[model samples]
Target: MQLWRRFTHRLRSRQAGDALLALPLGLIVVIVLADVLAARLPLGPSLLIVAPALTASFASTLVTGAIAAVAVAGMLIIGLDSHLLGTVDYGSQFFALLVVSGVVTVFCYLRERRARELALVRMVSEATQRAVLRPLPRQIGPLRVASMYLAAQEQSLMGGDLYAAIRTPTGTRLIIGDVMGKGLTAISDAALLLGAFRESAHRQADLPELAAYLDRSVCWNLAEPSEVETAGECFITAALLDIPDALPLIHMVSCGHPPPLLLRARQVSALRATKPAPPLGLGELTAAVYHVDTFAFEPEELLLLHTDGVIEARDARGAFYPLAERASSWTLHSPSALIRHLRTDLLAHVGGHLTDDAAVIAVQHTFRQTPTVVHTTDDSA
Candidate 1:
C-alpha cells in the first residue's frame, strides 16, 4: 500500500496531461463506443491487455501493475456481459492476458530499478567531473578564456580530455591535453596530469620546461618499475602555452598534440609546430625536447585548443568535422559565444552523439590600456 502511493504520486506529478496516457484511455473509450455500436466481437476484449503492456515503458511499475489489473477486470466484464465467461475460448483469453500482465509488471519493476541505479551513477559522475575538471574562468588577466567538454560514452559524464590555465611568476600559462582511452580510467589519468601541471606551472620558467616536467611526472606514475612502458596506452598528447601579461607574443610547446588554431580578422589559421616532441609518457623515444615556437598573439585574436575528438568526429556520411573551416567565420565572436557555437555545431555534425571524448578551449586576447610591457621575454634553444 505504501509503495502504491509513491508510484501514483510520481505518475501524477510527471506528465499529468501526457499524450501517451491517451493511448490507454482512448482505447478504453473506443471499446465502450464499439460495444454500443456493434454485436460483441470475440477478440475485442483481448486487446485490452495491450494498454498495460505499453504503459510499462513510461509509467512506474506499480502504476503499470494497477493498469494491468484494471485491464483484466475490464476483460472479465466483457466476458460476463457476452454470456461466455465460462466458455473455453473465454478461459484461454483470460489466462493469456493474466500471463501478459504478470510478465509486463515484473519487467516494469526491473526496468524502474535499473533507471534508478543509472540516476545514481550519473550523479556520481557529475561530482567527479566537477572535481577533476575545474571550470575555466571567463577572464584571466588580459585574455578571455572559455572551455567545453563532451563525454563519448553516455554512462560517463567526464572523460580523458583536459585543459587548464594558471597565472604564475613567469606569466599566464595554459595546458590542453588528451590522455589515451575513455571513461573513468582515462579521466583519472587526465586529473593526475592537470594536478601535476598546476603544481609545477609556477616552478617552470617556460613551456618546454613545463612540458618536460609533466612528461617525467606522467612517465613515473603510469609506468611501474615491473612493467615495460609501451607506446599505445598510458600516453598523453598535450600542448603547453605561455601568454605573458604584457607581450603580444605567445610561446608554445607541442607534445605530439594537435596545434592550436589562430582566429584572426574573421579567418582561421593553424599554428604548426616546427619541432614537435613525443607524447607525454614516451618522452624517452624522441629528443623529448619540445621546441618553444613563438607566434604573434595580437589583441582581438582567438586561439582554439582541442583534443583529437574535434577533427576525428565523423558524420553519418563518414565526413570528418571541419572545425577550422567552420570556426573561421566565428573569429569575431566572444570566447563564450565561440565555444557555444562549436559545441552546438559539433554535436549536430555528429548527429548529437560523439564516438570519443572531446574538449575545446577558446582564449580571446582583450584590449589593454597599458602602452608598453616592462617584462623581458625568454628565448628558446
Candidate 2:
C-alpha cells in the first residue's frame, strides 16, 4: 500500500512537470501559425528563439535541447512554405537561433554541475556537525532541557559555539562555551573543549576542579606547533554548572562567558559569578583561579544558558537584542516552550539573519520518579 502511494505521488508530480514543459512548444505553434497566416506582418521565424531560451530556465538540458530542436524545425517549415528559405535574412535568423540555443544548453549544464557539488559539500558539513555537536537530551536526571544552535554562515551547520551535558553520580554537569574567532579554527577549538569536558566532567570532583581541568586542556591543545599561528590569541569563554538531584543549590564556574539567566515566578535575573576568571586557554598568561559560585535553583524554575551571539545580535539600527527583557514575559513557560519562543523572537529581532553563530540551552528543574532516556530536539532551521 505504501509503495502504491509513493508511485502515484511520483506519477502526479511528473505529469505536472510534463504539462508545464509543453508551454514552450505551445508558444512555438502559436508563433508559427501567426507567421504563416499573416505573412505581411512583422511576425516571423525570428520569435521562435524565445521558446528554447524560456525552456532553459526551468527544464533540464535534454528537455531544453529537444525544445530548441522543435523550434528550429518550426522555423524551417515556416521559411520553406513562405519561399524565403535561401534568402540571407532567413539564413541569419536560423543561425542566430542555433547559436543562442547552444549557449543556453551549455549554461544549463554548468549550473547543474555546480549545484550538485554544492549539495555534496553541504551534506558533508552537516554530518561532521552531528558528530561533533551531538544534541542534548530532553530529560536528564531531574531536569527538563532543550537546546538550539543557529549558524551565522549561510549554508553552514556548525560554528564556534558548543555545549554538552553529562550525568554524574551526585548530579548533572553541563558546559556551554564559545571560541574566540569564526571559521574552521573556531569549530576546531569548540570541538576540542567539548571533548575535554565530556571526558573530565565525570572524573573531576568539583566544579572548580572540572573548570581548571578544562582550562589546562584548552591551553595545552592550542599551544601545539601546528596551531602556533592562531594559538597566540586562541581562547574560549565558557560556563560550567553542577546541578544536584536532591539539593536546591547550583554550583557554577564562569570563565569569561556570559552569565546564565534564572527565571522564576515571572522574574528574570542574570546569575553573574562573583569572582569570574579569565576565559580558557589564557589561564597560564593570567594565572587564573577558578571559584565555585553557589546559587538557589529550586524546582519549577528555568535556567537559560547561551553564547554571546544571542545578546550581541543587532537590528537594522545596530541595537543589541534585549534577551532578559524579552524573556521576562515567558517566565512561566516550560523549557521547550521557552526555547521555541526565544528562537522565534531572536530571529525576528535580527530580521531573520544573524551576524554571529548562537547556541542556547534551556533547563527546568523537575523531580521525576522514573528513569529518563535521551530525547533530543535540535533546531537548525
Candidate 3:
C-alpha cells in the first residue's frame, strides 16, 4: 500500500512538472517566431530571458539550466539570422542573458536545497509521530473499533489528540486524550500519557485505579521543570474505558473530558460522567478522586469518543458542530462506517480545515453469547 501510494504521488508530480514545462517551451517558440517574422520591430531577443526565469519557479536546477541553455541558443540564432551577431547591442544582450541565466540557475539550486531540507524534516516528523501515536487495531477483544486523528497544522499527520486500545484478560481497555497546548510540547505530553496508559492499563484492576495511575503519571511528567516550561499549567483531558468481553457494560473514568455519545436504535445520547474529576496533571494538586461511571453498552451499539475540537469546531455562521444531531441519523452504522461518516461530516462542518487537533474513536461491543437481562435506558450512564 505504501509503495503504491508513493508511486502514484511521484507519477502525479512528474505529470504536473511536464504540464508546467509547456509554458516556458511555448513562450520560447512564440518569441523565436516573432523575432524572425518581424525583424524590423523593436521586439529584441532579450525577451527570451523570460523562458529560464519562468522555468525556475517549478523546475529543478538541471531543468532550469537546460531551459537557460535553450534560451541562450535562441538568442544566438536570432542574432546570426538578423545579421547582428557582431553588433554591440547583440553582444550586451548576450552578456545580460548569460548573467541572468546563471543567477536564476543558482536561485533554482538554493530553492531545491531548501525544499529537500523541508522534506527531510517532514519525514522525520512523520516517523516520530508514527512511533509515538501508533495506530489502533480494528478489533480488540469483543469490541470493533475505528479511530481517526486530524491535525490542524497543514502538512502534519499527528498532533496533541491521541487514542489507544489494549486487550486485557477479560476485557478491552481504551483511552482518548488531548494535551493542553499545541505543537511539539503537546505531542510530547500526549505521547507520555499514551505510554503510561498502554503500560498500566492491563495491570490496573479497575477504572478508578487506572485513572488514578494515569493522573499520577501525568502530574509527575509535567512537574519536571526540564520537560515543561509551564509545569504548573499543563494538563490533559482524557476519557478511559474498560469494556468486558462477556458483560454488556462499560466502566468509564472521565478526567475533565467531554462525554462519549451512545448510538442505538436511531437515538443519540451522551454517556456523561456522574462525577468528573480534575484534568490529569491537576489531579494531584487538587487531591482529586476519580469516580467510575458504569454505562449500559449493549451489543451492536456504537459509542463515539471524540476530543473537544470536534464539538468546538465552528462553521461560517459561527455555530458549533451539531455532533449529536448529525450522528443521530447514523445510529445504525458500524464502527468503521460511523467513523467514516463522522469524519466527512466534521470536515464539511469546518469547511475542510480544522482550527485545532481532533481525535475520534468509534467502538461497538460484540459478543458471542448474549447476556440474559439487557438494559436499554438513556439514564444508564
- Report model 2's TM-score to 2 decimal places: 0.88
lDDT of 1 at 33: 49
lDDT: the better of candidates 2 and 3: 2
**lDDT score of residue 165 within candidate 3:** 89
lDDT of 2 at 182: 96
Q: lDDT (CA) for every model shown? A: 0.85, 0.91, 0.90
Give the Cα error of residue 73 in candidate 3, in Å: 1.6
Task: Rank the candidate models, highest TM-score first.
Answer: 3, 2, 1
Collision pairs in model 3: none
- C-alpha displacement of 323 in model 3, angstroms? 1.2
Model 2 spans with C-alpha error above 4 angstroms: 1-22, 40-43, 368-381
> Could you give me the TM-score of model 1 versus the true structure?
0.79
In model 3, where is the ten-residue run with the lowest total lDDT?
37-46
How high is each candidate's TM-score? 0.79, 0.88, 0.90
* Selected candidate, larger lDDT, 1 vs 2: 2
Q: Name the top lDDT candidate.
A: 2
